[model samples]
Target: MNDPTRAPQRVQVAIIGAGPGGSVAATTLAEAGHDVLLIEAGPHLPVDSAPHFRRDEMMQKYCNGGITPSFALSTSMAYLEGCCVGGGSEINRGLYQRTPDTVVETWRRDFHVDGITCETMVPHFEACEAVARVSPLRAPAPPSSLRLQEGANRLGWRCAEVPRLVTYDDKPSGKKQSMSATFLPRFLAAGGGLMPDTRVHRLRRIGGRWSISGTRRGRTLDIEADTIFVAGGAIRTPALLKRSGIRRHVGGSLRFHPMVKVVAQFPEEINLPGMPDPVHSVKEFEPRFSMGCSISAPPLLALTMAEHPDHMTEVDRHWRHMALYYVQSTGGIGSVHNVPGFRDPLVRVQFSRSDMAELAEGLKRLCECLFAAGAVTIYPGISGGVVLRTTGGVRGLPDTLRGNRATLSALHLFATCPMGERGDRCAVDSFGKVHGVDDLYLADASLLPSPTVVNPQGSVMAIAHRNALHFLERAAHGAAKPRSSDGRTLIARSNL
Candidate 1:
């Protein structure tokens, strides 16, 4: 608990949001001998605080109990963000992939992002991967995962196992290499200070420093820092900046992978009781879309089957045979707005006609692959959707999904505060320094110029590593000068 009456605490560097990006940045800066304080809006807990994919885990780790949604004129899509210390890394499956080379080139071409190439980013990615212990499953993948590969092989579609940030020790189920398990610990060991359950409400430029106004356990808390790094994920990072009156290109171009799920039931016991999420993903579509298996825990299956009441009982009886799969596409655009009175920001997303058509086609293709994998029955996630029992049934799917009936969700979100040299579009400069704001930076998914079309944690961490090093280099050159509240210059540390 923080004392409301205490004087404002000052630090050399303050980082908001103890997620993957913040954790990586904090660890790097701290190990370089900087005074860094990492703050999180949620409680700190062990990685295994709750079982993965369970309702209890959602309540414990997810933002808004995993019910955060972005409203569109025609429909709404639910997206999950982690509110805990480790952010999404603690709750996600830890599937890791570098930003595709094509995406990097596109960012450089379209957003004017500089010094970013596949080759230049390899070292940053390798550094983060080494810390997270990223590796593929040493043993054979679970049966559920093999089914996706089998289908892709039968159809001659490209598919392979996706590596994950997990530490394998001759066991089928390995420990997730979440921020709490990896970087956060390193940050702490390097003498970084951590303050959990501290929600920063706004940021104000005070002279040459940044003033952070926040609350901890409902008590007002204030902090002044010579340099500030905002890593509050995609949505909140932009929202916080918007509330602070820094609205240019902040949250205006949010992007995400619109995903639709389906529950497939096989005749055999395909889904084991404690099986991990399928590691294999069909990458035949690449940037346009991708197909992968998802956690089919009984609770999740119940939610996926809620529209089909008649099939609810199937979850209880045939859960061992049912598995969940998803088709996610890099379509649709969204924005984040701060409502005057509401604490949470309003997220509005809109999908175009072409986007709907693509999703419909992706859904049909997903069903075709599932049927090829020997699925006996398929339950689409859309409301009022029909169950398919044969390969020919896919032909009956709508060419364009009905906006009012589609049930869509997204796991990856980014580009809310894009980093580039384009002042007309970008919120931060090439290295993540906020445009026109000295010493203020962004080190999260918000800095992504566009969607990576894949799991983006790896990208977020690597970019953060790159940006943090840049900040340190600048500080070493005396670009960052510490200041006190009274506007007097303080002694600068020579550690960096």
Candidate 2:
């Protein structure tokens, strides 16, 4: 960690959260010859030290033992996000998918967003893929993934391999192009300053400069910068803005793809920890929900089996013959609130009745697919759901599966600080400039206006890259507006 007391260090840019967005932003700015400071609330663990064990990875990378839950009037669903220097890009499955063309068009027309479109976003996506080394699997898909592809084909559904951010050289220990592995290293080589395990407590813009005060190892620290960019994930981003007294639409309409999964027991081995994700996705019912493979490791299997204690014995007996698959349904509105004096924000998920129905339908289809793929037994992680053996058994799925009975987890989270041209509650403008804050911007999933219905990592990186370019173009035009001016003043002065 950089010494916080080393003479009021100043920089041209100070970015909060060293995740994908912040990493990309820092890399670009530093490469452009600007002084940059990157700060992350979590410790910067070396890539070489990333544990091979799942439980150790959870403790090292996850925000809270990978157990952040969505608080709902009905039930709470676990949501996980990385809290390390590399942010989510460090801990997530490297599945990569571009923003669907239809989604981009929808934002352009309905959200009044400009400059970003299906046609315009392609180059940004390509650039990010080039840097991240996104590519297809090096070897044949594992039997588990093959089963998914086979099932989707048997059901006459559209299924395709999902690309991933990995550097595959036909080696066992393939390199995932996480922020730490790629951009963070480049940023450091470009003379960017990074301070980990530092929490920003307050942010104030005074005299045309941004001032940040925070804590590091129980010691007070402060920083001053010409501009600041907050790239904290959706939950923390809005919380930080709200804490800074920028309350307008700071945390509203949070969204996430709530997922439901099943463990399928087969006669053959389908649990290969070394095999990469098959990346096969069933898009027959996309935009609302989609189905894909899930981790089939023993630890996860044991955890899921524990959901229904009766199935534990069976799962343990046939652990090597079992695999997992999941369906991630499009999300509904949720909210993030900053609780005073608390680091963790209060999250409320408002998954509607219709959303739940969609998930139930998806689950049914998933079970049928598994049976078609020769699954001897299928576990839906539902309390009353019986061990399914055939397609006929899927029809009797409960009319409405209660949240408590369902084992749901979500990784793809969006919104909370959505971007739009001029909505009353829009947090940022289309280009990612926070609506009412000058010298401050957002460069993470929080800028997404709605659910993306796909693995959001690729699009998240592309969007951040595009917006960072926008910021660079503006900065190239002139010095940022004096820090004394409020967000409204800066907006009125610039044509951007």
Candidate 2 regions exceeding 4 Å error are: 170-173, 479-496
lDDT of 1 by residue, 1-496 (tens): 3332265677888899989999999999989988888888988999898888788889988999887878889967989999989898999999999899999998899999989899999999989988998888877777778888888999999998999999887566788899998998888878777888889999999876788999988898888888899999999999999999998899999999989899999998888876666799999998788999998878888888987888899999999899889999998999999989999999999989899899999999999999999999999988775999999999998888757778889989999999999989999999999998788899999999999988999999999999998888877787764343353222221111
- Candidate 2 residue lDDT tens string, 244-298: 8888887887888988888899889888666776678888999878999877777
lDDT for position 96 in model 2: 85
What is the lDDT for 89 in model 2? 84
Kindly report which residue pairs in candidate 1 clash with one another. none
> Each prediction's Cα lDDT score?
0.88, 0.80
TM-score of each: 0.95, 0.94
Lowest-sum lDDT 10-residue window in model 2: 487-496
